[model samples]
Target: MRIALAQTEPLWEAKQENFRRAERFLKEAKEQQAELILFPEMSMTGFSMHPEKIGETEEEPETLNYFAKKAVEYGLYIGMGYVEYREPKSYNRYAIISPKGGVLTDYRKIHPFTFGTESVHYTGGDALGFCKIGDWTVSPFICYDLRFPEIFQLASPQVELIVVPANWPEDRVEHFKTLLKARAIENQCYIAGINRVGHARTSVYSGDSMIVDPLGRELAHGGREEELLVADLDLEMVWKYRAAFPAKIDRKPELYRKLADGMQI
Candidate 1:
């Protein structure tokens, strides 16, 4: 499938401007003949703690329906981040919109950044999300979730591709790249990470969005500018690699369960 990652330089907590920027990017991605378009972390609101600022409905709200409708109109699948309302609280969420403008799934950010007020403003989702789009079984994750490999492992051999939407800091560019490659190599799946650019509230993001093949090779990467990282990948490659070097099959799940149950690593 042809995948496009829009590494956006977002407007700090400004909802409308962010949407305008994303709409332009989506149009360009569609023009490029992309089947699926991915956006950076919190593409709509610039990754902030002011949950009270975002509204519930589509009008004055963050207006996710706008993107949904655009997806249908353009006949493209879109995966973008926003703060979704959940009555008394809100959650950092990714909306995977189908080509027909329908919501395929809404994956909430399971791992909240405790260093910021993310823990204060949002609650975590109970389950890790995995879904099928066309022929690909894909998984979605947010920024800090990259540190935990088990979440991706839970998806197992089912997920052929994993997408991470991150607001990673500029100083830790190496760590961000390291984990992206590690996730692809260890999971034996294709990985596409979209990170934002520019500074927001004293935190400058390193915009190194990329697409990695099953062999842990980066096919496409973005710079510290608002741009689209595009690449074509084969879904069958995951099975091809793992079958030749069946490491996951050789895993000692029985003993590992004990280690995962809090025994020292």
Candidate 2:
């Protein structure tokens, strides 16, 4: 499948403006024959601590209905991240709008970045979910979750493609690239990382959006600017590399299961 990543500069705390920006990018991506397009974490409301400005998280579908229609119009899958205002709490989520104008998935971020007060405002996700679309099995994860390999490992063998929508900071640019490559290589799968650009009032994000192959090679990456990144994903390589490496089969599940039971490995 041909995937496109929008390295957009979100108007901090501006959901309407960001939604307009995403629509424009989706139109362009459709013209390029992209099957799926991805945007950064909280693409609609740029990452911010002000819950009042970002509380649209509750009525997520109200905002996503616009994109869902766009997906049907363009006949392409669109993945965008935003905040959901659920009762008593909000969530950091990525919504998948299918080509048929329906909600494919709502992936809430399991690892809420507690470094600041992110955890305080947002509720974390409990389970990871993957969906089958066309010839690809797409798994979703958020920003800080990239540091944990075990989660991706759990989704492994079943999913050949991983989508990471993040608002990664500029302070750790190297971490963004290296970890993406490592995840792609270790899992023998494709990794698409979409990050934002520009300095928000609270933080500056490194806009290094990239697509990595199963061999951990970068197919495309954006610099520190708003841009569109497209990369062709080869499904054959996912199987080819995994067949050669066979890491999934090497897992000591019995021992790992015991460890999860609080026993020594």
Best by TM-score: 2
TM-score of 2: 0.94
- Write the residue-wise lDDT of candidate 1 on 1-265 in tens digits: 9999999888887877777778888888889899999988788778878777763444543456878888888889999888876667688888788888777777888888888768878888878777678998888999888988988888757789999999999898899999999999989999999999998998988798889988899999889888888888887777778889898977787888887898665
- Candidates in order, TM-scores: namely 0.93, 0.94
Model 2, 25-83: lDDT tens digits are 88889889899999888878778766556766444555687788888888989998877
lDDT of each: 0.84, 0.85
Question: Model 1: residues >4 Å from true position, as ranges?
Answer: 55-62, 86-89, 262-265
Q: Estimate candidate 2's alpha-carbon lDDT, on a 0 to 1 scale.
A: 0.85
lDDT of 1: 0.84
Residue clash pairs of candidate 2: 57-83, 57-84, 57-85, 58-84, 58-85
Worst 10 residues of 2 by lDDT: 51-60
> lDDT, candidate 2, residue 239?
84
